[model samples]
Target: MRKLVAFEHMTVDGYAASAEGLGFEFTWRAYSEELSAYGDEHIRADVDTALYGRATYLGMRDYWSAVPDDPAASQHEQVHAEWVNGVEKIVFSTTLESAGWTNARVIGSDVEAQVRALKAGPGGTMQIYASPKLVHSFVGLGLIDEFRIVLHPGTLGAGTPLFPDKSALDLDLVESKAFASGAVYLRYRVA
Candidate 1:
């Protein structure tokens, strides 16, 4: 069986986004070279399938797809963008009519069944990116095999949290690395 990993950048308070809303704006304060390299390494070494909700899928498609064409883009950014562009991207949504990016497709319904089938099939690690609602659902269903989180030093205080309020998960720490910027990368296997 393939591993289903939920990757998230979270505040110390456990929020994935600010109380204002869910987007890229709230999570980059503690970004560092170590964190960036770690992300790229994970993508290169572990992930072959990327999972996202409609909003995140659209956002990532726009950003990563354009990185290769940007003259000012760094080698790191270009390489990661290339990997993202080639990987199988599965967008989970009911309203998204199409996945316009390359190697991308839309799974409009039957999330639980489809996801289970994906996990059961042959593949590299499947990573769920910046989709808190989808992550929560996966967690609730006991579908996530691993949790890889970059915990920023500060707190959002109020925002879209990473986990559901009433649910509980038992996890075993697999790895932990602290970056110079006070950000910490934690990897846990669901127990």
Candidate 2:
């Protein structure tokens, strides 16, 4: 069986985005060497595929496929980009006609059923990226097996929230790590 996990960055107040998505003023605060390395190893060691919604998929496709091979690009950045470009990507989107990435497949409907089949099959860890809509569906539909989030410190005066609506969930704290970058990484097993 495959485990479905969500990897998200949230504010201290638990909002995933500040009005718009991960850009503009709300861009990733600062890159921590420790945290970035941890994230890279976390994915390289276990995760084999990425699950995304239309927006996240497109954004990632554009960004990762173009990690510049220049002096400005760090070794970590180049390696991370290569990892993303190599991994399989499954996108759930009704409006998207074709997957922009070669390693990507688009599912227009019956998302839950298809995802269930994916989980039933033999596979490595599947990580859901920055897609709040997909996250909401996976959580509310009781499909996700684990939730891993990095909680950054700050209160976005207003923005898209991680959990906009309240739904009772029973979860066990599987792991927690605090970084010198004022970020706390948390992993929870859905119960």
Candidate 3:
């Protein structure tokens, strides 16, 4: 079966975004390089489908779509923009009327079941990116196979946490890498 990978950049304090639902404060050294390489080698190579919540999807769509034309975009950023725009995007949102981007679809019903069905279907892999609420929901359903966390070296005292509820989880470390900027890339398989 194909794996369902959840990728997110999180603070040491476990918050994915700030209290106001903005994620600007979360910074990673060589983030564009890391993200672009991950997208090309792991995400784009293995997974053709992306799942997101409304807020994250919109935020990502706006940013990724504009990177190509942005004068300040780096070489890595431009590549990521192309890769993201080419892939299939599935947005799970109850309030979204329609998705404006190409290859984007709004899924408003039976999200868990649909995700399971997609995983069971014929595909290489599926990725869920930066959707904390959806990630927690999938965790409750025991759906995620692996988690790739880019742990940046910062602490937001109060913000939207990565895992909101108190639940016991056993994870086996598959791999780990420490960057020069104090960021650690940890890969864990649900055990």
TM-score of each: 0.95, 0.93, 0.90
Kindly indicate the candidate among 1 and 3 with the higher TM-score.
1
Once fitted onto the true fold, the runs of candidate 1 whose alpha carbons sit more than 4 angstroms away are: none
**Runs in model 3 with CA error above 4 Å?**
28-44
Could you tell me the lDDT of residue 136 within candidate 3? 85
The C-alpha local distance difference test score for the whole of candidate 1 amounts to 0.87
Each candidate: what lDDT?
0.87, 0.81, 0.81
- List of clashing residue pairs for candidate 3: none
For candidate 1, the per-residue lDDT at 179 reads: 89
Report, for all candidates in order, the number of backbone clashes. 0, 0, 0
Which pairs, if any, clash in model 2? none
Task: Summarize candidate 1's per-residue lDDT along 100-187 as a digit string, tens digits.
Answer: 9999999998888999999999999999998988899898888999999988889767878999889798999999988888988899
Worst 10 residues of 1 by lDDT: 19-28
Query: Model 3 over residues 75-148: C-alpha lDDT tens digits?
Result: 77787788789899999899999988989999999987888888888977788888888888888888899888
TM-score for candidate 2, residues paired by index: 0.93
